[model samples]
Target: MSAAPESPAERQAIDRLFNPRSIALVGATERSIWSIAANDNLRRFDFKGSIHYVNPKGGTIFGAPAATSCAAVGAPIDAALLMVPEAKMIDVFADLEAAGVGGAVILSAGFAELGENGAERQRAVAAAAKGAGIRILGPNCLGFANFVAGAPIWTTPLRRPMADARVAIVSQSGAIASQLEQFAYQQRVGVTHMISTGNEADITIADAIDYLARQPEPRAIALFLESVRDPARFAAAVQAATAAGKPVVLLKVGTSEATARAAQAHTGSLVGDDRIFDALCRKLGLSRVHSLEELIVTADLFARLGPVECEGLALTAMSGGMCEIMTDQADAEGIAIPTLADGTLKRLREALPPFATPANPLDITGAAMLQPDLIPTALAALASDASVGALGFVFDAPLKDDARGFARSFIRHIGEGFKAAGKPCVMMSHTFSAVNGEAREMTDSAGVIYSGGGVRHGVSALGHLAAHHAWRRRAAAAADNVPAAAGTTNAARPNGERDVLDYLATAGVPVIPARLARSADEAVAIALALEANVVLKIASPDIAHKTEVGGVALNLRGEAAVRNAFDTMLARVREAAPAARIDGIVVAPMRQGGVELFVGTMNDPQWGPAIAVGLGGIWVEALKDTSLRLLPIGEQDALDMLAELRGTKLLDGFRGAPAADRQALARAIVAIGQAALALGPDLVSLEINPLLVDGARVEALDGLTEWKESE
Candidate 1:
């Protein structure tokens, strides 16, 4: 089977499944209590669409008339929910297709996710659906349901009715998907769509996201993915979401090697290459959450508050000790809580009592909670200040009667005030059980994300959210133009040193002039023509590490020095590598520069071509500093690549030395990436070690390339 082309009309038709005019439940039966429960939920949620049940058993399901099959259904069916066994799914899909069904959600298992035989069966099902021009959601999936449309295709029965909100969840795991639904229900958070992309035999999480992005309801998307089958497609979907102003929060399940292996074994999907996946996510501007709880909380915040445009945050707590702890947390997470400006400080000082300190993370005495509106007043003053980007409130449980009322009133007032001011605010309290029922209700109704257990978790969550916002804005502004492709050429070079020079020069990398000589007389003539101190080294493709075998002799001043070093180097190399074939001597002018650098390219087994840049010379191993980026990177991205290196400070005039030419380095890196991308995996590795970088110039001192056997 060939890959299918994107069809805009077909995608639109697929969208109707989430908001169908009428639905037919094929193979619906009383014995399938799960299906019956879903039907009951539709009615309970006051679904406006018509529901048709097709069961040969001929009984009423949730008081709806049951048709024997799709042929007997009199009304037009927009979508069909199939709950039959795997063997009967193909026929059911065919019937639905004949009925002009726009989409079908298969609730059965035993497809590609099961094993080899199941994979073949899944292929056959996909082929049949494609031939009929029907969009099939799943063969081994839990099915999807839109809470906004009151669609009742979900496998698990929803205990609570759906609330209207801006968060949509899509998960590969059925259990996780159900858990998200329940979590939202418990928190009274609104959900637009909940999907479990089981097996992903045809429709994937990316496809679902693309569909959801068109909906005007959802402001954010939360994803739970064990593996990404098509990274390019996923990245495109994420980009689309970002363009639509919908933030995507991802909970990636497989972190360790064991977990990755287990995911593959369980689902027949690859999951181990986390580095490439992370790079893809970062490039595409996706928020990565570590845990399930964090996923919901962050989604809730993003959905309710929208994007916050603050440079730094202001933290306030009832206890001074808690403020100190939060300081450490903020420092470790790289969250900036700058000192209060003079004007803002004066306003805060005036608003609070005499003992209150006007600083970032202002710690009011515990007695302040006794005042009915003290916390909210402080938050309002801080949020109104232009210097504050966000506000954090911390306190123990509101125990006193007045304190409890004050907590409820303050949360309600602050929530409304933040909404009006368009600022983000978070609340932290250890008095989870002490708050009155009314106060708890106020907290929930206001949509405030709270952490009662620990300060670190709360601070970390806020810091991550803030960083994500910052990174997204930056990535959005970064240049996205694709770099021009570099053309290939063949150059004549009989020896290793000449070949290195030829290749580097062809790629616009400056290199020292070099020549190959069969005898010492030829080496002397070449050195005279170069008119500088020359270096001579034994040139042999078979010799990988030349210095180890005494094959290199540097800085030959004249004829006598060149002749003696040439003879000694060749003899030592021949003795060291007896079986190695030998090439004669390579003579080159000595190169001098400000700093030494290494740039190399390697083909990753999973991510294809990638480039690496690092500090060179003796400190290479000691520093172990390097930065890697996927190949075919743009020139601006190349600059970013260089800046990511840990030793980048050295290039920027460290220790009062002249700064190296960053633009020159970026150009060289881009050139290397173009070459690697063109040659592909056939060129195994390319290295330019000790590349000299001066004030505004760069030169490749030495380089090597390994080629693969022709196919």
Candidate 2:
């Protein structure tokens, strides 16, 4: 279900899978584990749709009448869940498809994970599924669940389904999906859908996300993924979800070598570069979580309070110790806990005793325990503060019912007050197990989010929410102001150093003032005309690393010195790299006393044009500290990347050295991004090493450009 219509074939197939009117269990039985579990869970969950059992032996299953085959049943089946063996899977699918089944979820293993033979069988199954216009979920998958439809197709032990589902968990690993479900239920978080896109031979994770984006029941989406099969469709789905006002939280593994190899062996998925995936996530406004804890916690926050739109947070507590703990956690996570506005302080002073403090992490003291009204009054004042975008109330509670009730009363009253103001509020307990049914009910009724895990988890959730809010705004602004890269009408020819410099200069990246000279006398004349100490380097596309090839000379002060250096540089280049296609020598006036930096771009096949910035000079490789972001980024993004570097103090003039012009450097970075956008795919890669940065000036001292192809 896309905002735009899905292809007629695909749309009908997805509809049949998620909203099946009639389901036929292909390998229905009384004894097999998966079959028994499926039948028992369906009956327990009380699926409203028509259910049919098909067994070759013609035995009834779970009191449902059995049919010998799809034709014997003699009706159109919407979906079939097959628990058959690998050898019989293809034939079973063919029977269902010929019987006009719309979708199939095959729970058989031995496909892809078993190597080449299994891979070949999986391909044959996919071809048969497509030929019959059937959308298949897996040839080796654990099943899916649609809680809203009361269709728990998953074969697992059951808890009573949640009444009001809000978050959808879509994962590639069935075991992980089940683990997440159990964890969510244990934490009292409601889930709308649990989909495991195992193997994804036909229907992909992208398709599932796209379909879920149009579902009204899910307020947020949590994706547990290894890789994306279709990047374009995946990106579009993310955009659609954002536009539809649903947040997408993602947990992607495969960053390490062992994990990547494991992923390939397990699911036969290509673990693409994780760094590129990270950049893509940032570009798409996806909140990427690294662990299972983060995934559940982040999604719970989104489901409980909706999207967080504020940048600052206010923390209120009854105990000063709890407040201190929360403040420490917030600071450790880099979450902003701003001071209360003057008016907010005045209001708090009137409500609380003189011993109570009126600041962020405001400690209302034990006085609030006696005067219950003080809690709501303080919360209202803090929510009304101009600087506070969100609010959190943390209180200490024991595991006893009485303590839980007291905590509940405080939360219910605070939630009621903040509900009218319509800002997000979080009710957290000092201990994870202390938050009981009463506290959770307060959240459900009052629209306040409850984080049962202590101060650290609560603050971490708030930190992630606030960061996403800020990034979304920046992404939106960039989208409106910047144009996307256009289609290439013509290819670019391979460029030499002069061509690279000329192209960069036109794009506002300040290249050093230089001239190409074929002769030593010509190079000396160009250096003397500039009337400054000059550097000469052999200009050749083949000799990209000039210094490594002995093609560079520095600090020639006189005409004779420049002429001698030019001849020596040519001779050295010939001796070092005799086969290089030398394109003459470039002589430029020397720029001194500045920090060496690098700015680069690559038209990433998956993410598209991205810019990278780092400390340059010869140690660029040795000191691999750098930051990257997708192209068409603003000046602020460029500046933020610079500030993120570990060596930022070097740019700030460490130990009495002159501070480099960071603004100038940021502009140069932006210009590189702009050039990348303008050139599109034709500009394969561009690198400007030793981009010198002095006070209020930046220059590209040397560069290399790789083209798409010659016309």
Candidate 3:
């Protein structure tokens, strides 16, 4: 099958669905039990737009005159909330199309989620909608809410509408979207848009993100993803969002075996390789969170304050124990809470008691409770410190009536201080009481925030916020330097080992000295000329994994041993792979005191060319310890990849082993990546197994390259 065209979301149709001037509520009824839930939500949310009720009975519904058919209504409907049954959907859609409806929210199940039979019917539904040039939100979804437009077509209950919010939640699951919406309300996280892309038969999560990216009202987008249906479209959408200076937080599931299966069944063909998805996220500057709660909280930070500007976090608290706990959590989350600057430290010392030490996670001591100015002064100093990226104060507000006055005062002081500092700030507490409605309202008014999930979640959210900011900077820098594409293809093109070595050598990648010989006498002559212990391996294009086929012999000392091993290798390989057309054998001098490493390239179907490095030899597969990065990477990127390896210490003279040449290893990695990029789409993969690295020396001991037949 040919590849699908790189198509963007139907923006006009999506706009009609979310920003519709007029809507038709199909299957509307006053009987109750969700038959008219969509209508009720629209009215309750005070949708500032026209709503046309549609029912086949042709009577009054929701205090509006109903029409039997959309065509009979004699007016154009921008969006249709189809609460009708699955079987009658085609007919209703036909009438809707005849009436020139632009979009539809199919709040019915029994479509693709059922089985192949249902999937066939779904294809027809998609075809009908496409033929009519209308967009669909779902075949099984709760619909969406355009809070900024005052349009809440969602079927689930919602809190009072919040206008002019900055975050748009785009989700694949209807229930999860609704749950997030409610969670946002509870956390006082204002959301401008909430979209549930159920089934994604017409409009997918990517479509929603793309549409939201172009909208100015939302400063951030939170995505709850099970899988990506169209990777190209998804990537384009993310790029658009990043270009628009919008932060997108993604909650991608399917890491577990059961979830992967469920994801495949839930959204047909959506369970892509999760690792590639992760690499894509890193490349695109999209923040990926594990849990829905983390998604909500992290998005709230972005929506409220935008991206974090600084790299270090400054924590302040009266209790040393609480400060220590917050510090530990911050470290665990990879959030750098740097030491206070000398100037800031001096200022803080002068503003506090003599006994108070000025440092990161500054302990202001209990005296700050009485001396209100002390806390604000310390905050101002920390906020102004160049090292501090963001600042947070740990405090609590009890819900008791007697303590209410103190709580209000504490919230007001913290909010006022943080606002005065002119930096992102948070008032944190060990309990959720610190985020009461009153507190949230106060912080919202003061342009501050209250994080109340204790030190764990509070620090985690801060870490995510910092990472989002850092990734954006990296992505922006890398944007100016687009890496050339690695020639790749879907067809199989096997390359012999000598061909791989020749290609790498031309590209400046270091390779062991080797010569290919077609006869035993030639092999003996080549080994004798090497003047040292040597390795011999069969060279055959059809036999990529030569070791598995018993085609390799190592450490042959003399000409006699070399000739005998060469003959024996040929015989064993022929016995193992009779169909393989053996070309010759490769002979190279054996080198000692080197760390074995694997460097390889892969053409991921979703992410494109990627480089992988790990401990090589037999342990490569057994340990499965490796690091991966997208291609077009530079020397620094290669070094970073190596640093992430679980066995990175092995290269640093682990267990009295000589330290491997890290600089040379990095250069080799870069060379491999550059070669892959130059190869472009025709190249399938290039692997250098056991790229032996001794002190200040690196050599590709064995190599393999695969490409397309066209190449």
Best candidate according to TM-score = 2
Q: What TM-score, to 2 decimals, does candidate 3 have?
A: 0.88
TM-scores for all candidates: the values are 0.83, 0.90, 0.88
**Backbone clash count for every predicted candidate, in the order shown:** 1, 0, 10
* Model 3: ten consecutive residues of lowest lDDT: 262-271
At residue 632, candidate 2 shows an lDDT of 74
Could you give candidate 1's per-residue lDDT for residues 1-711 as a string of tens digits? 012445886786687777788888888776777687667777776778888888877778667788888768877888888888888777776677668888888878888877899999999988887776777787777788777777767767775444457789999987898898777665455688888888887788888888888889888898999876665667677777878988888899764343243222211121124644565566666777787766766676667655667558888887788888889879876687877778778877887888878777888666464663565666776777776777777743343437446555656654554454457777766432333434445676766544442455556656666767776666556556546444444433223656776777876777767888888889888888888888887788787667889987877788888888888888898899988777688888876547887777765444455566778755555675666666667667777767877678878886777898898888877876776555544665676766778777787777777665467
Give the Å shift of residue 320 in candidate 2. 4.9
Clash list (residue pairs), candidate 2? none
The regions of model 3 sitting more than 4 angstroms off are 1-9, 255-272, 339-357, 397-404, 416-421, 432-434, 445-447, 488-494, 538-582, 649-664, 677-684, 706-711
Tens-digit lDDT track of model 2 for 322-410: 88888888887778898877888899888889887788888888787778777777888888877777788875433343744775666
Return the lDDT, model 2, position 607: 56
* Clash list (residue pairs), candidate 3: 486-680, 486-681, 487-679, 487-680, 487-681, 487-682, 487-683, 488-680, 488-681, 488-682
Alpha-carbon local distance difference test for all models: 0.71, 0.78, 0.78
| lDDT-superior candidate, 1 or 2 | 2
